[model samples]
Target: MEKFTKISGIAAPMPMINIDTDMIIPKQFLKTIKRSGLGVNLFDEMRYDGDGNEIPDFVLNKPAYRDAEILIAGDNFGCGSSREHAPWAIKDFGIRCVIAPSFADIFYNNCFKNGILPIALPQEQVDILMNEAQKGANARIEVDLEAQTVTTSEGEVISFEVDAFKKHCLLEGLDDIGLTMEKVQAINAFEAGVGATRPWV
Candidate 1:
């Protein structure tokens, strides 16, 4: 996982609520376990038509938001199934941060694990971000993980809360595998001692 410290970039506004995993990557795109290629398929159903052509009206397909690195979505974002692929697609698409009024517990946890910052804020704060996102590439939003603050293009500051452990993990680029590696020396020592004391067993 890549470290997420601070990011200032374009934010795409998706006001629809209840954006589930299926809508994000679709069942058809789940065959591959790899996370790299999923960005093209992110929001596949919404981005393509029946014939597989890009929809002009989709926020991601629009020229201004094609490179959006942040998302400002409506309430109840990431509801339904606990698929890790959802965050993978979002991250692969270059979205480092997501701001919403609320998020599903499993999805919120998955974001941090995948190096994506999922921010939950009050409705008023989210509304402010959503409005800023509507400006597309012209307005950039800044998310400072260390400070736990989001500054809009107009310099409006909003504070958000994140768990200390999760913040540390993201800042240090430590995923489950990375965390385990931190204890390698201790694990090796324990194994050596066990072999010396209980070789017969």
Candidate 2:
């Protein structure tokens, strides 16, 4: 996973609540295990019409938000099934952070694992960011994981909380496998000793 330290980019406003996993990438697209290429299908139903043409009114379909790296979503974001593909699709779309008043527990944790920051802020603060995001490409939001702050284009700063351990992992680009790799030398030594003592096996 890529390290997520600080980022400044377009912020897309998605105010709809209860955005489940299916709405994100859709159940039809869940056939693949690979994470890449899912970005094209992100928010499939909302972004496309019955003929699969891009909808003009959708936030992501709009030119300004096409490259948005952050999402200011409504409450209960990432609800429903615990498929890890949701975060994969978001990250693949170049969205490094998701800011909402609240998020489903499983999805929230999965974000960190996939190099995405799922921020939980008060509704008032999220609304403020949402307004800023409405300004199209003219407005850019900055996120600092170390400082735990999200700064709007107008210079308004809002702080959110994150677990310290997870923060360290993201900063260091350490996923579950990366974490274990940190102790590779010790693991190798222990394996060697076991082989020496149990050579008969």
Clash counts for the predictions, in order: 0, 0
| Error of model 2, residue 38, in angstroms | 0.3
| Alpha carbon lDDT of each predicted model | 0.93, 0.94
TM-score of 1: 0.98
Worst 10 residues of 1 by lDDT: 26-35
State in Å the error of residue 144, model 2. Answer: 0.4
**Residue 148 C-alpha lDDT in model 2:** 94
lDDT of 1 by residue, 114-201 (tens): 9999999999999899999999888999999999999999999999999999999999999999999999999999999999999986
TM-score of each: 0.98, 0.98
Q: Model 2 reaches what TM-score against the true structure? A: 0.98
Candidate 1, pairs of clashing residues: none
